[model samples]
Target: MSKSIKLLAMFGFVAAVAACTSGQTEEEYVVVNPEPISVEPTYTGKYK
Candidate 1:
């Protein structure tokens, strides 16, 4: 392979690797549970 072509390929590989690994972090999660809730309906004069 030509020198310049090989160099470009290596640079591309390094750049791709760096981008893939730059933001490595721990995973995040959310836990939810069911709960009872009470609500009142609004009244209008038309209902009466």
Candidate 2:
């Protein structure tokens, strides 16, 4: 019974350490906006 108690304690310690170290990753993000384009008239001469 004593050996089984020691084994359970060791397993619990390992699980706690694994959980603490597995969630430490952080990500960064960036956003960008482009300018709009302008269009001019095609014909400017008078028609008969």
Candidate 3:
């Protein structure tokens, strides 16, 4: 029917607009190594 054709055309137009606008990249990420932590030994006094 004519109504179905109009609805299909509208859907196609919307799909085309969405497809055109969805291909943008805005951000990028990079991975890096983390720093190591150092530990100090605990000293015990000469008491029981």
lDDT of 2 by residue, 1-48 (tens): 999999999999999999988787657788878666877667867882
* TM-score list, all predictions: 0.47, 0.53, 0.51
- Give the per-residue lDDT of model 1 (tens digit) for 1-48: 699999999999999999889779658899998675867677867857
Candidates' lDDT values, in order?
A: 0.87, 0.87, 0.87
C-alpha lDDT (0 to 100) for residue 5 of candidate 2: 100
* Residue 29 CA displacement from its true place in model 1, Å: 11
Task: Work out candidate 2's RMSD over C-alphas.
Answer: 5.6
Clashes of each: 0, 0, 0
lDDT by residue (1-48, candidate 3, tens digit) is 999999999999999999888887557889998886877767787773
After superposing candidate 3 on the true structure, give the runs of residues whose Cα lies further than 4 Å from its correct spot: 29-48
**Worst 10-residue lDDT window, candidate 3:** 39-48
RMSD, each candidate, Å?
6.5, 5.6, 5.9
Q: Which ten residues in a row have the lowest lDDT in candidate 2?
A: 39-48
